[model samples]
Target: MLVYDVATRTVAAANKAAMRLYGYSREEFAGLPITELRPPEDRAPFLEDFDVLVSRDGPASGTRGVRRHIRKDGTRFSVEPTYHMMRYAGRRGCFVVVIDVTEKEHSRELLSRQADVDSLTSLPNRKRFNERLEQAIDDARRNNTGVALVFMDVDHFKDVNDSLGHGVGDRLLQEIASRLSSCVGPSDTVARYGGDEFVMVVLENGANSDSVAGGACQCDRQSEVIAHVMRVFAAPIAIDDTEFHVETSIGVACFPADGDDAETLLRRADLAMFRAKSNGRNGLQRFTPALGKQADERLSLSRRMRVALSNGEFRLEYQPQVDLQTHRVTGVEALLRWHDAEHGSVSPATFIPIAEENGLIAPIGEWVVQQACFQAQAWQESLPGLRMSVNLSPRQLARGDIVCVIQRALARAQLAPQLLEVEITEGALLNAGSAELLEALRAMNVDIAIDDFGTGYSSLSRLRRFRAERLKLDMSFVRGIGVHREDEVIARAILSLGHALGFSVVAEGVETDLQLAFLRRHGCDVVQGYRFARPMPAVDAYTFIHRFNAGSLVPS
Candidate 1:
């Protein structure tokens, strides 16, 4: 609390509390100028405002909002001052009270910053990035320049998070954010767009807007920025004393060429990034018209697939697997087929990947399991030993409920577990939770086959650890058995290795007489392909199996 003379603008009196706050003695504070309480930069404005307040005819007794005040030690803090017009010892004076609000203001500022930042990496979040991108686009339009958006995704990031724990994954993301930040300029903005994905907006002044040879805008500045970003991942990232060679797929979309608005630019950049990943990852791509068309087609197909599943447009075809020595159908593999009302006979090769990407595989896979189990139960009346082999996708295994899904399917159909076989690719084994899922299936007496062997990076240690019942030679190797010597040698080695490890070898895509002879000579336990019979519907498969087993249908 203090009192100041209106005429002289000097402090007339101060209470003990005011002396303690200002770090001054009573004698020193008594005649101090009122402006001295404010910092030097604020003192001039304080006097002008004070003069107007004193000249007013009415009493001025209200809060003056918030202002900065310097203590005797020269430390500045925020305070709210309230003053009243009054008389002190027969002299015109003002009585004032100050309330410190430094801590409250600080808390508000911190909350504002936290809303714009990513909690893990301390980079700007997507919301802040979008806001800045809109502003950049506006500025570029005025300056006749370009703004390039770079969308990046960490390749195989889920493998890192699954194999290593999420703790290591978090640390790895932090390191990636730091490396990305080091590659951009002051004018550029880098942000964490969400999980394993980062985005950047680079201002390209005087960039060439003309189309290049490949239909891409020739933006030299953006090219340089992308090159710098690529080099950051050239070296291995070391985390917790372990080195990992991380890879990223980047897509570039420039303003006024790929898109004019922020939303359009972001979508196009995302489409281009997927193209980079499809071109085998660890690369970069620019947005083009053809890429946009492809994305639209993919989106249309994905929507159709969801509706197809609900409307029963999907069905299963079984390809018979024959025993080598007896030439009899031993088991059948269930293959999914889709026949759309508008576009008939869509190939599995085209739609399966889309299913996996859009997360439709989980529901589709469950339906396949239930149908296959019921079919196998129906076939048991004629062929008791026939096994129903169904492919299990890596996505399903990662969901952590695949074993229970299979168990429920088998129990509902009253099918014996021994008659069911779950076929998984070698690539699926590399995922986390797969081994445990396979072990759980094995515990229930269900057979496990490593499908498409030699098509992935399979180590002897993984083979020895998983201990699958069967190893299916991929069709690529089987197709080259008679023509390519390298393929023949690989096929022979795989057969020898499979037998040595007590795994029954099943040769896929065996279409020729020479290929069949080669596999029979090498002791391949089973074979399935066009040589026997093409994939048939359930009714056709049941009749074909009866005819083949009764020695009526002969192999061509």
Candidate 2:
């Protein structure tokens, strides 16, 4: 090992091991300066520490322990740089020993990088995004600059998962990540924020920083980025020889404009993205106060709906369906009504679709069935021949559990299957072939009528396949029976087709005398309209049926 001389400031001598440790010839070690072992920038600090060591002890004492150093090749490795407070070449000096730690330091650096990088996309993850955002925020505050944070989400991404499968969904996400990376500059960053959402941060530059001192200016840039992103995402991305199209809706919230912090800005951007999807897909939106309020309202309404069934906030109204020939109350169709505690009497049109989408329709449907059957049993006890018809939504049909629900309701109500009619629209039956629940319902010998028959797409062949007992013509076909030739022809044809198939035909929404006369002429088995009775509660329906049977009814 070489000994370092403090008084003379020279390398006195070197052993073979010391010369090899520093990748130097013995002569080279003797000629080289001690400062050569340290980085140029660290040499000043090293020298200051050296002066303190020399004052406390001789150079040999300072070099007694290990010291870190770099080689002449500019490669760094830690060294003991040990020294002994003894005479070297008749001068007080120190002996140095070196040990290499290059591999260990390199490994630590690699692990640090791996922690920040995403394994799949190879882009940064949300963790790295947060850390980078903190630095960016500090920089923005110091330089008085602007930063934009964009939140982008894929539109109809669930469809990809549903139709193509999750494998394709994963591939699509990867391709999208690549395309997004291409759109942004090197100074900006794009991160996969989780799920199908991504976050991008772009800092303001040059003169733009002064004009837009807040991060929200990037909200305007959302349209530009979205246009490029959409064009890139719009074209099909292929997976396993199949090409799939993808689109996105972006929400933009600028730093300082939306919020200076990460959480607030991210939340706002998420809200704006949801707004874009709600307004219509394939678009971008900036966060707004009104949109936030609307989201809060919808969330409140959805929460209330979830508890509605449990709280017994629902009611059923029955509208009579009369037989024209017998002039008797053949059946009453059950309609659902909701009386919201906050927003009273919500319309079926408004909440029904929401219920279906949220998967709440199945339970709500069961309640309707049980209530309708119980009411029909009550009416049958009073009138002896009345039937109750309950409408089935498409969502309920898709689940294929309607038969089991009906069986349970009938058992609870102690009602005969014939007196309980389930009305399913044509749309519900369109995909009923593979539905075991529907097939089970057909096997039960319960009356299944195709309600609003002509309102949906149906074929003569498909109509024959359904286990239906009656066909109720939609109001549209019955609206202008005598006035419009097409309407008359369609109504008559539907009635004829129903009769030919051994099914009873009923004309719904028959409000006029002419429409009733026209249907009676066309051999319609039944007619239901405001002319007979509007949908009313059970008490009124009982009175209306009694009055009609007594021939004491007045024309409205």
Candidate 3:
């Protein structure tokens, strides 16, 4: 307990409790003002203004601000401070009562962190990011300068979450956020914003409106901030000392010229981001009027896609994955196709993302799995022990229902689980949930293969964790087999690495003898594409396999 004179601004009397809490003896504390108990930075403010606003109080209410007291050893702790007018034995003064609430302070700190920071990446959360953006815009407008907002999110994030364990997936998000912060200037703001989504703001004060507008020259600042960031993100994000492919679609918008307010600018920038991902992910697009129209068109397409799902307009196609060594058909991957009554033939590349976006991917994917299993069973008599490879969408995998669907499909077709291989992208194998699902599939004797292995950003750590049975080399690398040494190196590396890891390598898109010889020499176990035969109907595929087995049909 301490009695402080408001008139003289001095501590008049103190007890042993006060001395012990403060590490100050009676002589040391005598004649000192109450402000002396505060840290150096807060002392001046307490004397100049805080005293006027905070002192002369009853029980400390929410209206009274929280303050801290510093010990002689320089340790500061939060205290609940309240004072009331009282007369002491000798003089009249304020009787101050302080209750140290360090534990409550710790709880407050945790709550504050949870509100402002992303739990997974420890970066600024969406609310904090928005606050920073709003502040930047205000400052930019006052100074007649520009503030650029960069909206970015990971590409194929669903694949990572669905394939890898959630723990690794979270670690991947942290890795990306850490890399982004490294490239970001101290004055700029970088935030996680949300799952796999990030937002950044860079302030350029004293800029003219022309420079603030989204144009070719907006990227010409002396610091070249955007270019530097792009260069940094170009490298694959490394996690646990292994590479996980990282790519993002970035959208940029400027203040004043692009949009005066936060909502307007964010909306425009987000539209541009959608354009980048739709055109091709892993790129940047600045806000423009045209892109907004395209965005509207996409929204229309998404609505149409929801309708298409109800009408049962989706179909499946099978592409055979052939064994190179034995010259036998190992499996066929089910592919989705859709023909819109109004738009004619719509490519999977176009409608597939829309389906995923509109929440139709799960049901559509379940249908494909069931249909493909039925067809595989129908052809099993002619092609005994033939396998069926079905592609699992990221959404289906994220929901972790693909395994149950696979079990039901096998039951419906009376197909052996060994003859059912589910093809998944390397991106899908990075999260804990995916690992659990894959482990379940493995336990059921279902074959698991990582589809398009080399093309996507991959992690070696995940490969050994997957218990995968096959590695399907991407067509992009296979097409360049004889033409590019770099492609040859990558292909050979994949085959060698895969074989070393005990995974069968299925080289895709083998259209020429040169490609075939290259794959065979490199020890690829399987080849699939036009070089052997195109994806055929179930009946033709069975007959083709029978003839090939009888030595009547041969590779061209």
Clashes of each: 0, 6, 12
Question: How close to the true structure is residue 242 of candidate 3, measured as C-alpha lDDT?
Answer: 66
Model 3, position 227: C-alpha lDDT score: 72
lDDT of 1 by residue, 1-556 (tens): 9899998999899989888888878998978999989999999999998988899997788888999988889988888889999999998899999888889888978899989999999999999999999999999999888899999999999988888889999999999999888777666789999999999988786332331212234357778667777788888899988898989999989998999999999999999999999999999999999999888877888999999999988899999999988878999999999998766788998888899999999999999999999999999998888999999988888899999999999999999999999999899998867888899999999999999999998788899889899999999999998899999999999999999998999999999999999999989999999999899999999999999999998876
- For TM-score, the strongest prediction is 1
- Model 1 scores a C-alpha lDDT of 0.91
What ranges in model 2 sit over 4 Å off?
1-118, 126-152, 187-189, 199-219, 238-241, 250-272, 275-280, 283-288, 303-311, 322-328, 352-365, 383-387, 391-406, 417-434, 444-532, 546-555
**C-alpha lDDT score of every prediction, in listed order:** 0.91, 0.78, 0.80
Please, what are the lDDT tens digits per residue for candidate 3 over residues 79-171?
877766766666657677777788899998999989998888888898998899999899878877788888887898887777666777888
lDDT of 2 by residue, 1-556 (tens): 6677777556667787766777878778775677877878778887787666666643335342434577768777765555456666676665655555567666877798778877667889989998887777778778877677788888778767878788888888898889888766666788998888888876654323322222234435444555567677767888888886777788887777667887877788888987788788778888887877766766776788988978998888888988878888878888999889897878898788778878889999999999988888887767887888898888888786677899999999999887887888887765634345555776776878888888787788877777578998999989968779998888888988899999998788999988988889889998888988998998998999888877898657
Evaluated at residue 406, the lDDT of candidate 3 is 90
